[model samples]
Target: MIRPLLLLAAASLLLGCAQQTLRGTGDLGVVVERATGSVQIIETSHQTRLARIDGLGDLSHASVVFSRDQRYAYVFGRDGGLTKVDLLKQRIDRRVIQGGNSIGGAISQDGALIAVGNYEPGGVKVFDSKTLELVADIPATPLADGSRNSRVVGVIDAPGRRFIYSLFDTDETWLLDFSQGNTPKITRFKNVGKQPYDALLTPDGRYYVAGLFGEDGMAKIDLWHTRRGVERILDGYGRGEQKLPVYKMPHLEGWTVAGNQTFVPAVGQHRVLVMDSQTWKQTDAIDVAGQPIFVMARPDARQIWVNFAHPDNHQVQVIDSETHEIIATLEPGPAVLHMEFTARGDQLWLSVRDGNEVQVWDPYQLKLLKRLPAESPSGIFFSSRAHETGL
Candidate 1:
């Protein structure tokens, strides 16, 4: 019995050494399997599925951000679970329940801190990226009339060691500055707009924009000049118009910039609003087939791709960034949730939730390149995204 036990130990040691030799690449990407609380890691260059890891908690609305080294992935689960996964090993390194309900998270510019926005207790929590230790707990303070805890969304890292988020109940936006110490210096801007659901920071980390759910415009904050306060842009752009019934609120994450123009989705309207980043004004509106959910620009910035809300989600439309005209519309099957481009924009991956597959397409040729199966997939994020700002 002693001899057999020694042989088993030797075999285990050899297996561990074999696993250590396996290496991961920055070109690899992950697709969320929301139904099973799992993610499938894939090699984007070859369009090959590598492995599927399960047991992640409540991934119904999961979002992922990577560390600066691109070796660790921080997955924010809707059930308030913050999981740190080692991409090289394809396993979870650490996990903790930081809140009652969570929306998403972001890693600091220096990669020392990870901040998550909560909905239940309603505030932001900052943690040590490496140790998963709590560093700060910022509660969204109540309003003058004593409203309930405001749901926090779009917590994004800024250039100056600061994080920005919006409070849904108070109708205000706050900047939590952690530059000096772990104790965040809170600065609040009042009357930004009603129900600012989600936000986006430009690639340069200069502008932070929030979409208003209760109004027709969006609130923009120039982080470069915080004293100017939150300025309203595209104010009442949809006023006095007969708008369609919106099945889902347009996602600000879908809004993107191409060349000199930033394309944004018009709420409850079947159109995409174009804004000039230089002039900070609404320049044009492109009519689409349905209510736009995601207006994303490919990595090359040569064309913009648009996806729609339910009932029209089966269609994907491509627009020429220069002419702002619809060039092609392809049927990518049902429940097309998200899209991601390769590092150089050579290949575009589309996640089809209902179809249970991810389809890769060649934009110029307007042809289907390949299709891979996924389980209720939503977001497709790559490790190369770590080097980009406001991912």
Candidate 2:
């Protein structure tokens, strides 16, 4: 809790606040797929190489978005640079240099606005999805002691709602309402759990879950009533306290919601943790490759793919959610980071962060479909099958 003294101090130092939102529609449908350094476009239907856009610069591609019309794709680099590509011509359209490396982002559901996270100052930049212009930039809450600055990590359009949720490094999450001038009032939570990494939502859009890195636990909270109190899961103890250890590195990536269940990887455990969406209890786990980053799931939740950062066995392990068994080991090599599936679920987009290329895989046969290149690729997203983002 904020002590009365600290509260009074914070109240006196309040400088100002800012919020902005836009209306109408947008152009281009963009999803930034990762390659260590190359811009890749995977075909939605077959995960085929639709095209490759490259030579971004010294900074690596971290987050990407395609224009609504599919004419342009914007790629964000780690050090605040943007590369605009022509999806049709498969060339450079334009680029914008913004804040810092993008941890995550949220595109307005209508495709009008785009918000990206900057790591250094933990700034959030709002952009015009069409012209790719900077609309507004909001700096994260500063620390009194002035530690390493905070960054916005993950962001998504709240399912069935107009509010946008953003996670930051400061152990806090903010709910931004687009209905009222796009200004998101920060809701402060004291015991939100340390190192809160990312959040996932249910298909029906009733629940929102945030992953906790410090503990073997995750905060499974109600979307609408999250502030009331959070439901706990796998909350084990460590040392002299109930503080659980997920892993020394944790490296909790994105989350996959399968049917009424949600699956997430414990990077260190090399296993997928199973949980019931309703109860939010970790039910079971199954073996997979080392350092499994993110999971891919279809609407039916029949097929699930778990990708890894294994140097030797860098492949996506396909599993049958029903049997909870690994059916296929789909490898798309040269060392990659996690997987991004196209909207249709036939193909997969894998980021080759070390190779500067994005690898596409066939979800069924464990075969390599094709390869696309980008500059120091990182985030992989499919707009049609868009989720909050594991990036």
Candidate 3:
């Protein structure tokens, strides 16, 4: 009887050990399954899907941010669902619907707060990163007529525990400093431009620039010198050219900086604009296959990969950073939604929405490495983003 009991106890111990295996999340990432309202957990090292988590609401335009520890992912859905996903446990730890329509979100410098921007109600909400509890709710500035609150866009995490964003309806930019307490000290920069559609923060977190959709330029604000106010750059960039109809708006977050030059997509144009990082002046414009949607740089900044909007969405063009010329053009498939590079830039993963799979590529050789199945994947986010200033 004692020998039989001992054997059963030994079998139970082995089962417990097999069920809990230790691993690291450095190579782990999540791919947004937009159509199914799910996310597939993937690992770069193996180039495979580990698991798929579902129940995330309305992920048509979803975005993700990682916790400081890289063990959790905060998914911001278009339906205003803020979900805290446990990457290790492969499940959602918490979820809350904080607004009517959410566009995107960002994590604080200290990783204690998560800020989300909304489109319907028009405001930014801050929540405790750990508990997902509301910390602060900042309504967007009202229009001159006091009709409605401006729609918040370009929400990004900056250094010094600050959050900076643009006002689409009010033509303004704001900086919310939370270094003090839960109540933030707000700094408003008015008359930024005609319509600041989207914005991007430099990798170093120094300059925050907003792209104007209603005008031909961008608005720049130097965080180091807030007293200098907003300076308009690339003014009259499309002065004489007959603009084409933009089927889809370009994403400023995809703006890339290679060497000393910044590459940005020109709205309603089939060109990628290159500007000097120091002077903020247009250096050259490289014509591409179509209206540029995401103009992103390789992790090492050696090449620029560009995707396009509808009618030309089937193509992707690569540009040589130093030569400012088209190096190669490849057709991955229709609806090349997003591109993400590995931490060291060795592998490039692209979400081919129409193809219903994510293609892994060797960026240096421009060779297809592997393909992982996904359900209408749109965004591919890695754990390495936790350390980046503005992802």
Candidate 4:
């Protein structure tokens, strides 16, 4: 009887250990499953999945920003739903629908505020990151024809606890300063460019560059010296060439710097324009497979990966940053929506939407390593991004 009781106790202990739940920390990430409105938390180190949190409402175009501690994720959904998810518990702490439609979001430098860019009834909304309470609302009032709805994009946080964004309808750029108090001090720059599709801040949060859809060049702002105001760079970039009809606006998120050169995607063109970061002058152009959607660099800055817009979306082109030349072009499968590198950039994970799976690859070897099943995965974000500015 004594031996049987000891055996039963040991069995119970083993069962409890097997049922222990996993938490989000250390090399953790999430895959946005747009079709099902869920995010699958993954442990990238072990190539294992942790949990899928659903009911995130209309995530057809979703983006996530992690908290400072990396234990919480703030998901911005297409239907204007903002959800604060506890990565440790695999549950939502709070959620609110603050607008009619939203494009993306950003967290302030100090992680005290969150700002969301809107498409419908265009404007930007800010909320407290901790409490999810409304802090301020700034509408993108059209400067051209007095219209109210001006789609806002390229919303990002800079130093000094400020948020900056561009207006599509009015062709304007606005900066909101929140350092002084709860009331934001707004600064508007008019006629910066036509139809600013999207923008990106330099890694140091020094410059904000906006790509134009209605024109040939992009608008650049010197955040460190706002007195110089906004200037146009890469003017007439699409001149002389008969451009292919743009199916999807080339994403400026691909605007990245490798060494001293800034690589930018030319709208409707199958080339990436390279510029000197210091001079903002066009230095060269690299021809690619198709209209480039994203031009991301490896962590070590040794290679740059270029993904296309469509008709050629299945491919990824790798460029040697040192030589300024194309090294390899890989066909990772169909409808490759996004790619993310591991924290160390040793492994690259890509989402093949048509294949309904994510594939990991060795960037240096240019070889496929492993594949994991997913549900229409679009974006792959890791917690390490929390430490970077203008992410």
| The candidate that achieves the highest lDDT relative to the unseen native structure | 3
Q: Cα lDDT of model 4 overall? A: 0.89
3 versus 4: better TM-score goes to: 3
Of models 1 and 2, which has the larger lDDT?
A: 1
Off by over 4 Å in 3: 1-20
37-149: candidate 2 lDDT, tens digit per residue: 55555545443555566666533336565555545556667767766776666678777777656655666655676777777667677777767788667777665578856
Model 1, 327: alpha-carbon shift in Å? 0.6
Order of models, best TM-score first = 3, 4, 1, 2
TM-scores of all candidate predictions against the true structure: 0.93, 0.75, 0.96, 0.94
Best by TM-score: 3
Compared with the true structure, what per-residue lDDT tens digits does model 4 show for residues 171-246?
8999999999779999999889889989988988899999999999999999988888999999999899998988
Clashing pairs in 3: none
lDDT of 1 by residue, 1-391 (tens): 9999999999999999999887657788889989999988888878989888887889988999989998888999999999998887889899999998999988888889999999978899999999999999998967567665888988888888889988987798999888998898899998999989988898899999999989899999999999999999999989888888989777787688776889999999999999998776999999999999888998888889999999999999999988999999989999888888888888889999999999999876878999999999988889998887675
Off by over 4 Å in 1: 1-24, 143-147
> Which 10 successive residues of model 2 have the least lDDT summed?
18-27
Error of 2 at 370 (Å): 4.7
